[model samples]
Target chain A: MKKVHILNYGLGNVFSLYNAIKYKHGNVNLLNKKQNFNDVEILFIPGVGSFNQAMNILNRDFKKLLIHLNSNKIKIVGICLGHHLLFTEGDEGGACSGLGLINGKIKLLKKRNSSDVLPNIGWREIKLKSPKLSIFKKYDKHKFYFCHSYFSKLKYSNQSVFSSSYCHNEFSCMVYDENIFGLQFHPEKSREIGLELINDIIRY
Target chain B: MIQRIIGRIDIKNEFVIKGINFEGLRKIGDPIEIAQKFYEYKLDEIFIYDAVASLYGRNSLFELIKKITKEIFIPVCLSGGIRSLKDIERALLSGADKVGLNSAIVKNPKLLKKASKVFGLSNIVATIEAKKKTDTYWEIYINNGRDQTGISLIDWINKVQDYGCGEIILSSIDRDGTLKGFDLDLINFVSKRSKINVPLILSGGCSNYNDIINLKKKHKSVSCAIASALHYNKINKKDFLKR
Candidate 1:
C-alpha cells in the first residue's frame, strides 16, 4: 500500500484533505517531517492563504528537504495557492518568488469589463480537454467547485491537461509533466466526483 | 425584472439544517428536496451554505447536490464549507449553478480573483456575513461569526467588491431567522459603499412585508433579501408581488 504525504505549512485544512484522501486512497499521512517523503510516493500541498506566506514557510522550515525531494521523481500535487507557488515568479503585490516549478508569473484576475462580472465565484464548468486525464479517469459530465482570485497562466514543462473557462479565458485545471503536478481546484472537497479524480491520481 | 428568490440553507453536517428561530425546524430535510421545491415554485435561485462550513472541514453536500441538481431545473448556488478553489470546483461538479462563499472570501480575498478567472464572474456569489454594530454600521464577522475582523461593514463590502465578487449575499447573523425586519442600515451601508453594483441580497430581520417595504423605502426602491420570514411563512409572497 502506497502512502500519500500532505505538506503541513500551518495554513490549516491539512486534516480535511487528509481525511478525504484517506477515505478514498486508503493510506495517508500528515507530512510533519520532510523525511516523511521517503515513504510518501505522492505529495499534496493544500491550503487557503497567501501563496507567498505558504511557500516562505516551506522554504524556511523544510529548506533542503524540499529541494532534495523534488529530485526524487515522485509525484507532487499543488492545489490553489500551492499551484501558484509552483511558478517561477508571482506578480502578487510585487515580484514575490515561488518554488520555481513552472515558468509563468502569477498575477491577479484580469479586471472584467463593466458588463463582465468580477471575482468569478460560483460553480463554473471546466471544459476539460483531456478525456484521458487520470484524475477524470472514472467520471465525466459536470462542473467543479471553485473560489480563487489569482491564477498562474502556468509555464510548466507539460501542457495543461485539463481546463476551465471564465470571463473570456480558459485556465488550466490540471497541469503535469513527469513528476510535478498542479491542480487549480481541490479534488478532496469535490465529493464522490472529486474522489474519482483522487482515485485516478493515486493509481497514477 | 424577475427578482431573485434565493433560499438560505444552514447546514451543520451531512444532515443538519440549523434554524435558530424555528425550534424543531432543525432536521435532515433534504436540501435538494427543498431546492427542487423552490424550482417548482419558479424561484430564481437557491443558496445552500454552511454556517459552520469550515469549523468541521465539511465537504460540500455532494450527495444532496447529486440528487437535487439532477432534478431541479433552476440554478443552485452552494455555499458553506467553501474556503478555496477546490471547494468551489466540488460544488459546481455537484450540480451547483454557482458557489456562494461567505467568510472564505473575507479570509482569502484573492480567492475571488482566482475563482473568477477559472469559472467566470457569474458563477461566483460572494456572501457577506454581518453582525450589527451600534445602529448604523454592521461589523463584518468571519469563520462562522466566531471572530470579528474589526473591518467595518462598509469597508468589507468595498474591499470584497474590489476583490471581484459577481454578486453579494449580505446576511445579518444576529437577525438571521428572526423575522423581525431586514437591516436597512446594513443594506444601505453596503450599497453606498459599493461602486460596482453587483446584486446585494439582504438576509436577516424580516418579520413581515413591511420590513421589505421599509427596506425598499430606506434604500429608495433598492431591493433586499429576507430568509426566515419567507422560510417560516411570516409574510406572503403575494403581498410583495402585488406591490
Candidate 2:
C-alpha cells in the first residue's frame, strides 16, 4: 500500500479528499505543517479557497518541502485552487507567485457572453487531449464537477492532459508534468466516476 | 450550460422531513439514507437544510453533514442556522462543498461580504426565501420563512450579489411543497428584475417531469431543487436524468 498525504493548509476541503482516499486506500493521512513527508508516496493539495490565501500559507510553510518533493519525483496532485497554486503566478486576489512547478499563469475566466456565469459552478464534460494517455481512459468524455473563477493558462499545450470548456471559453481542466498533476475540478465531490479517477491517480 | 437537478432534504432533528408551503412537517426518512439514495440516483447535487436550525440559534447538522459528505461523492450544500463566519468555517470543515446563508445575512448583510472574502466567493451561496406580496412584488422572508423582512425580492437579490454571494437559491414560500409545479411567474419576475449573473437555483413546487421541462424551456441556464416531488416518488432520479 502506498502512503498518501493530504496537505491540511486550512484552505480547502481536506476532509472530503481524506475520506474518499481512506475509503479505498487505507494508508492515507492529513499532512499538517508539523507532519513530515517521510514515506509519503502521493501528496494531494485539496482546494476550496482563494489562490492568494493558499499561496500565502504554502509559501510560508511548505515551499521548501514542496520543492524538495518535486525534485525527488514524488507524486503531487493539486485540486481546484490547489491546481492554481501549482502555476508560476495567479491573478486572483491580486497577482502573486505560485510554486512555479509548472510553466503557467492563472487568470480570471472571461465570459463569452453577458449571460455566462462566473465561478463556473456545476458539472462539465472534459475532453482528453491525447488518446494514448491510458491513465485518463475512463474519464475522457465524462463530466466532472467544477467551481472556480480563475483557470490555468499553461505555456505548453502538451502539459495539459484534459481540457474542458465553460461558456465557450476553453481551459485546461487537467494538466500533467512529470510526477506533478493538477485538476481544476473536485474529484472527491464528483461521485463514483470521480472516486475511480482518484483511485487511478493514486495507483498510477 | 448543464441543467442541475439538486435533491433537497429538509431535516428536523434526526429525520428528513417535508412540509407544505414550509409548514405541517412530515417525517420522510433518515437523512443519510436519503442522501445515499440520491447519490445512487445520480442527482447533480444534494442540499441538506436544517429545517429548524434558526429557531434553535445554531446549526446542528455538522456531524450529519460530515458523515453524509464522507460517503456521498457529489457536491453537498448545507444551509440553516449559519449566523457567523465561524458557522461557515465549521460547515466547510465538515466537508460541505458550499454553505447556504439566509437568516444571518438578513440581519447583518456584512457577514456575506466577510465570508466571501475569507472563504472565496464560490463557496458562499445566498438562499432567498420569498413570499409573494402582490401582483408584481415579493417580500423576503427569514428564519425559515417565519419572519418577513419587508425587503423586496429584487432588492435583496441585487444586494446579495453585490455583497459577493457566489450563487443564489431562490425558493418560493407559496409554492413550497404544494406539488403544483414551480412558480414560473415568480421565477420569470425575478430573472427579469434582478441583475443576477451568477448561477440561480430555483426551488419549490415541482411535481413532475413536465414541471422541470417547463422550467427548462423558460429558463435554460438555471437549475432546480426538488424536495416534495422527489420525496413522495412523484418524480424519480430517472425523470431528472432523462431531461
Candidate 3:
C-alpha cells in the first residue's frame, strides 16, 4: 500500500495516469499545491499544452519539487510538456529555466522545410537501447503514442533517449538515468504500452 | 500496428446503457454482462460511462466499474460523473484506465487544466455531445443534454484545445439511440475545425458498418465508439475488420 504521488503542476492528464498507476497497486495520491507530498518513492509530473502555460502555472517551491525529488533519488517520470520541462532550458516561448535534471532545450515545431505535420501526433516507434531497462520490461522494442508541439535537445548518460522519427528528424523518448524519465508522447493514452510503462515506473 | 477495437459502455442507474430507447424501457442487456462479452470478444479498450452520474450526482458507479475493469485485461475509460478532480481520482483508483469528463467542463472550463495537469492530456478527454442546430451549425449541450450551455460548438472545440484536453469524443446526443442514421453534422464540424491534434472519438447513432465506414472515409482522424447497434445485435463488431 505504498503511495505514488502525481504532481498536479497545473497541466497534463492526471486521471488516466492515476488510473494506470492505481491498477498496479501504487496507492496513488493527487498532489496539488495545497496538499502535502512527503516521502513518496515514485513521483509523476505530467503536463499537456505548451511550455509557456505550464511554466506560467508554476509557483514557489512546487515548481522546483522535481529537483528535490531527484536529489532524494525518487523515481520521476514526465510526459509531453512535463518531459520537456526537465531540461536545462526551454525555447518554446523564450529562454525559460527548467528543473535541469536533463541537459537539453525545448524546440517548437516549425512549418517550413518540413514534411511532417504539426503536433507530431499519432502512433510512432521508440527504438529501445537496452532490454535490461526496467521501463522496457513489458514493452516491445518499438511502437508508442505521441502528441507534442515541443521537444528536448538534451542528451543523457545512464538513461536511453528513445527517438520518434515520424517527423523530419528523430526526437527523444525522454528516458534518462535510473531515476528520471520523460515521454514527449503520453504513456497513459498509449493504451497497453503506456500502461506497462506506468507500472514499471511505479515499481522502480 | 493491430488496430484496437474500443467499446464505449455508457451506463445509467447502474442498468440501462447509453443510447438505450426508454420509450421502449425494455432492458437492452445487463451492462456488466455486455461488458464481459465485449471483453470476451477481445476488445483493445473499454469505455464505461455513467450517463446519470452528472444529473443524479451519485458517485461514479465505481462499484460496478470495479467489477468490469478488474475482470477485463484491456483499458477502461470511465466517463459521466467526473465533476471534480477528486471524482477523476476516485474513478482512477477504482480501476479506470482513462477518465472521461463532460458536463462540468462546460460550467467550469478550468477544470480541464487541473485534471490534465495531474493526469496528463493523453488521459484527459472532453466528451462533446453536439447536435445540429437548425441554423446550419452545431450547438453544445451538457448534463446528459438536459441543459444547454449555449456555447458555440466551434468555439467550445477551440476552448478544449486551450484547456489541454488531449482528446475529444464528439458525440451526437441527437443521434444517440436512433438507429436511423448518425449525425454527420457533428462529425464534420469537429473534423473541420479542431486544431489541438487530439484523438476525436465520434459516438452516437451508429446503425451499421456503413455509418462507420462512411465516417472513417470522410474523417480519417476520428474513431468510432459504438453503443446501441452493437447491443441489439443489429451490428456485430466482427464485421469491423472487413472494411
What tens-digit string does per-residue lDDT give for candidate 2 at B1-243?
A: 567889999999889999998989999999999998888778889999998999788679999998898788888889999998888888888988889999999999999999998888999999999999898999999988889898999999999999998899999999999999998989989878877789999999999988888898888888999988888889766765663
Candidate 3 lDDT over A25-69, as tens digits, reads 648888878565567767788775556567667646475665567
Binned by DockQ into CAPRI classes (incorrect, acceptable, medium, high), candidate 1 is incorrect
> Which ranges in model 1 have alpha carbons more than 4 Å from their true place?
A115-118, A130-141, A156-158, B1-156, B159-169, B172-193, B196-243
Residue B239 in candidate 1, Cα distance off native in Å: 24
* Top-down TM-score ranking: 2, 3, 1
Candidate 3 versus the native: TM-score?
Answer: 0.70
Each model's backbone clash number: 34, 0, 14
Question: How far does residue B55 in candidate 3 sit from its true spot (Å)?
Answer: 3.2
What DockQ does predicted model 3 obtain?
Answer: 0.14
* TM-scores for the candidates: 0.59, 0.98, 0.70
Q: Considering DockQ, where higher is better, how would the candidates rank from best to worst?
A: 2, 3, 1
Can you write out model 2's per-residue Cα lDDT over A1-204, one digit (the tens) per residue? Answer: 888999989856677888888877777888888577777789999886788888888888887778779888999999999888899999987899998989989999998787788879999999999665686877988989998989999999899999999887899999988899999998888877888888898888
Q: Candidates 1 and 2: which is better by lDDT?
A: 2
The positional error of residue B1 in candidate 1, measured at the CA in angstroms, is 18
Per-candidate iRMSD = 10.2, 1.3, 5.8
lDDT of 1 by residue, B56-144 (tens): 66665866776665544444678777878877767665656577776667777888888865655556777777887786667887766
Q: After superposition, how far is residue A99 of candidate 2 from its true place, in Å?
A: 0.6
